[model samples]
Target: MNDRENLCLLHSKDLLDQKRLFLLFKRLAGQHSVSIAKNIHETIKEFNSATFTEDQKLFEDLYKIAATIENKVIDVDVLKQGVNKLLDNRKTIPQPKPEDLCVNDSVFQNKILSKENNQKTAPVPAVYDMLSLLYLTTNEKQRQQHFHDLTKYYYRQLKDHLKQLSIELDEILPLPVYEKKIKDFIPNAKLEVILHYLNQDAKEDTFTSELIQELYLYVLYPKINIEDCFKIAKEVVGIDYNFLSYELVEANGLLGALGQYYKLKLTINKAGDDVVLNLFAKFMIDFPKDAFPGGEDAFPKVGDAFPKDEPPTLSLQEEFVYTIFVPELKNIGLGNICDFLPRCYFMRSSDVMVFEDLTYSDYEAVNSEEPYSYEMLLLVVKKLAKMHACSLLYEEITSKGSGETTKINVQFSKYVMGFSQAVDTKFKDTIHYCNVNTTVNYVYNQFPDVAKEITMEEFRERSRDIFDSMLDKMKTSGKYRNVICHGDIWGGNILFKFEGTRPVDCSLVDYQMIRYCPPAQDLMAFLYINTDKNTRTNYLSKLINDYYTEMSTIFKRYSFDLSTVYPYEVFMDSCEYMKSYAVCQAAAYYPSSLDRKKVQDLLGSIEKTVRFFAVDKTEVLKVLMKHDWIRSRFREIVEDLYDLCLQK
Candidate 1:
C-alpha cells in the first residue's frame, strides 16, 4: 500500500511471504525510478492470490525488464498500454495472502531465491518460462557461479514443492481446466513426484495432471514457426548468427563445446544458454589468429588471413588449437605462412617445441640442467635491450599516427585477474603463477642485506616510494612521454626465429602481460629470471656491455646522447631498485612447468643466463664511476641500494 512496503519485496525470499514479495514486486516493476503505477499494489496482490504458489523476485525481475522496455519509449500512451498489459496478466494469476503460507519460514522468506529450486508462481504460467529464459541467457561463468551458490541449501525443497502441487489439481479446479492448469505449473516433471502427489493407481490415472498435460502438449504439439524460432533463439537465448568464411572454433565462441578443448569446467556457449551445440558451427575459444602458422608478430600485415588453399575443414582454429590433418607438426603450414625466416616451435599456452630446421642444441635443451646456450643467451639479452629501447622512445615510435601504437599493453591483465577466480583450480590455486600473496612476500625478501630494506611494516610505503621515484624518472626521460614496454618480458616470449644457434629474428607473443614503465625495468627482470645468482655475478660485466652496445645503437639514430640518457650507473641503480620484479615473477611462474609450452617459455628466458658467471664486488664500483647516465639526483638511490649487498 505504501512505498516502504513495496521496497521490501527486494528483501523478501520465500514464495509464501506474500506481502513482502508483492511489495518488492511493486517497487521493482512499477517504475524505472521508485514512482508507483496507478494500481501496482492491487495487481501484484491479485497475481499472488491466483497463482498456485507465489514467486516474488522472478516475476518482478521479468516485469522490471518489461517495464524498463516500456519506459524507453517516448510516447506516454504506448507506455501506459504496456503497463496495463502487465497488470492485466498478473490479475489472471491467483493470489495467496500472507496468512495462507507456511508461517515457520520467515527468515527463509527474507533471503534470495534459489535459482535452481525457485518456483514460477505467477498466474501467467509463461512467467516461469520467462525466468528460465533469463537463467539460460546468462553467460557461462556467471551461470555456473549462481548455480554453485544455490546447489547446497534449497535444491531438494524446490523439487518437492513441484510434487505436492500436482496432487490437488482436480480438487482445486473445474474438470476442463484442472488437468491443464496443473500440468502448466510443473510440466515434464519426473514420474515419482507425480505418482506420489496423485496417489491413484497408475492404470486408473489415464488423464495426466495439468502439469503433465502441459509437458505432453509441448512435446507432441510443438510450436512451429521457423522464422519465429530463430527470433526466439537470437533474442530470448542470446545467440549470434554471424558466419565467418571458415568454422574457426576458437574465434567462433563455441557455444558449449569447450569441453573439447584443454580440459576444465569452462564450457564455451553456442548461444548464451544451453550447452547443446548447433551443427552449423563448432563453439571454441583458442583464437584462430593465435594458431595461425605465424606468431602474432610474424603474421604478415594484410596477407595473413586464413589461407584459401585448404578445404573448408582445415582453418587455422581447428588445425592448431584442437586437431590438424597435416602429416606432421612441421607440415601444419608454418611454411605456408612465410618461407624465408626460420620459425621456432613454441606454444604460448604450453611452450614445448621441436623444430625441423633447428641447429642449436640450446633451444631444444630447454629441458637440460643448463637450459641455455651462448648464442641463445645473446639473443635473450638483445631482445631485452630492444624491449627497453621501445619503452625509452615510446613517443617517437608512436609519433607517426594521430595516436600511434606504443609497446605498453595490458589488455590481457584483466583476463589474467579474472582467471584467478573463475578459471580451473589448476590456474587459480597455482602457488607461483597467480599467487599475489606469495609475490609481495618474495619482493620483501630480496636484498635483505641492505639496512632498513623497507620493513614489512613499511612495505606499502616503500612500494609507493619506489614507484614514485621510477615514474619521476620516466617523466623527465622523454618528458613524461615514455614508450610503452612489455611489463612482463620473461622468457615466455624470448625464444626467437633461429636456425638453431643462429637467431634470425626475435619475436614476442602473449601480449597479455604488457605494461608501460622505465626501459630498464624489463632488462633487470630478464636478468633475474634468466640467470641464477651465480650466473648473474659472472656475466654482470658482459651483460652490461651487451645492453649498452644495443641501446647506444638505437639512441644514436634518435639523436639522444646515450651517455646522458641511460648511463651505466643509472642502469645499475635501476637494476637494484627494479630487481624486485624478478622475485614477483619467480613466485608467480617458478613451479609451473607442468605444461610443456609453459616450461619451454620460462626456460627459454632462463637459457640466456644459466652460464654461471660469478659476481665481482669490484666491478660494480668501476662501472659506476665510468658511466655518466646516473644523474646527480639519482646518486642517493644508487648509494642506498648498492649498500644492500657486496658481491662475494
Candidate 2:
C-alpha cells in the first residue's frame, strides 16, 4: 500500500490500538525531542474528527511533524526502521475468517496458529504485547504513557481494557523484557501487577516486593568477571576451575542493619569434574539515604549516630579482619586458635565481601529473643577469650622482635563512641543523645521516689558524664594490656553451632567495629547486653573467670602467663570500670531490641522517629512509656545506671 493508504489504515484502528501506534510515533519523535513527540501525538489525534476533509491533508500534517522530528534525530535509519515497522503491520491486515467473527477486529490482528488444526485460530499475543513486539525492543527506553494527565475514571477504564490483553504477555516475552514493555504502557502499574503480567510471583506486600526487587537487580546483574570467580574458587576450595555459574539467594530475614546478605551458591568445573561451593556474600550499603529503610526522611535523624562516617569503612574493616588480621593471627598457629572465624572466599572492592557459608556446617545464629543460657554464654566467652589471647600474642611477639612496643595497625582501633573527638556530633545525634536521654527522663518522672534528689537535668548530664568517662577508660594508659576488642558484641553477632540440644561451637561474625582496647570492652558489653541482671548476679564472676582461664591457658601455650600480661585483679577492675559504659550501651540498644513492635510503632512514620528526637524528649518519652516492655527495660536500666553513677 502507499503512504496515504497506510496512514488511513492506521487511523481506522480503535482508540487503544491508535494510542499504541501513537506511542511508536512518539518513541520515534522522542528520539528528537519530547515536545516533538507531543506535537506528533496531538496532530494524529485530530485525524478521527468527522470534519477532516481528505486523507491527503491529514497525511500531510503527520508528514510535516515527521519532517521536524527527522531534522533533530541523529540516526535517520533507526527512525525510518520504527516508522516502516508500523506501516508493515497495517499493510498486511488480514480479513478474519467467518468462523473467527467473535474475535475483536482491528487493523493489526492479534492471532497465532493453533497446533491441533494448524489453523490461525488461537488467540496468543494480547493486543498490547502484539503492538509491543511490532515496534519496541529490549534496548528501548523505559518510557510510559503519562497517566497523570488522565482523569481517574478514564485511567481505570484504560487499565481494565489493557488488563484483558495482559493474559498472553508471558508466553511471548521474557520477564525482564516484558517488564520494560508493560511499565511503558502502565506508568502507575504496581510491582504486583508487573509481576503478574510477567508470570512471576511478587512478595506479599509492597515494601517486601520493592525490597526483593532491588535484591534481584543486585543478584541478577552482578558486575563480575570469570577471572574473579576462578580466583575465588582457587583460593577458597584450592580448585583451579576454568568454568563457573552461580545463583544468589538473598537472606531476607537476616538482612543487615546497614547492608545486605546473600548466599552465593556456585557450580564450577575443573578437569571435567564439577564442584559446588556455597559462600556468604555481604554487601555494604555506603549511603543509607538511598538503599536502606526510612530513606531520606528517617536517615538524617539517625545518620549522625549510625555510622554516617563509618559505612565506607565498615565493610573494609570487616574485610580486613577476614583477609588480613585473622589470617595473620591464624598463621601464628597458637594452640588455642579455635576455628571461630568464617573463612574468606572472596573480596570484591570495598563494598562486597564473601565468606564460607557457615550454615553448610550447621552453624546458625541463636534466636535473639531468647536469653543466652549459662552454656551458651560460656561458649561465647571462651571464643572471645581465645580471640583476645591471640591478639595479645601477636602484639607481644611483634613487640619483642622489633624491640619496641608494637600495636595493632588497624585504623578502626581508635575509639569512636562517647565524647571522643572523632565522634562529638555522632554521640549527640544518635542513641546516647535521644534514646539514652529519653530512658533517663522516663525513669525520673515515673519513679520520683527512686529518682531522689537527682534532678532530670542532672540525670541527663550524668548519662553524658558516664560516656565521657568511658572514653577515658577505653584507653590502655599503661595500666592494662590492650587486646583487639569486637567493638560490637551482642547476641546478633554470635553464631552458635549446636549438636542436638547441646551448645558446641560458635563463631564471632561481625568485626566491622573492631577496636584496640582491653578485653573488658567486649566482655562487659556482651555480658550486659545479652544477659539479664539476675543472670549476671548469679554467674558474672564465673563468666569472667572462665574467659580469664581460657586466655590464661592460651597464653601458657606460648610460654607466657596471663597473670603478668592481664592479671585477674586488673581484669576485675576493668570490668567494674566499664560497667557504666556497658549499661549505657544496653540502654541505647534496648529501645529497639526489647520491644520491636513498639519500636516499629514509633518508626511507622520516619517522621515520627525524626520528630521524636528533633526536640526535647518530653512528649516522646510519654509515648514511649506507654509500651510495657519499653517502660520495664528503661526502668531497670535507669536503676542500674543510678546505682552505678548517682548512688550516694
The number of the candidate with the highest lDDT is: 2
Tens digits of per-residue lDDT for model 2, 1-648: 332233221211122343544444333222212222223223221111111122343333332333443213223344334334434443453542221112121122222112212333222112232232222211111111222111122223323432454422122232323323332222112211222222212123232232223222323434332224445666765534444355677764452344567877777666788878888878765543432233444332322443322332445456657766776776776534846677777665445677888999899877545568999999999989988888888888777877988677433343222222234334234534565556566555676655566775776677667756665655444566677777777766788889999989889987766666778888988888887777888998899889999889888889888898777898899887778878878776664455444454554443454444433445645676776655665667777877766742
lDDT of 1 by residue, 545-569 (tens): 7877877876676665667656777
- Model 2 lDDT, residue 521, Cα: 81
lDDT of each: 0.33, 0.53
Residue 266 C-alpha lDDT in model 1: 14
TM-score list, all predictions? 0.32, 0.57
Question: What TM-score number comes out for model 1?
Answer: 0.32
**TM-score: model 2 vs. ground truth:** 0.57
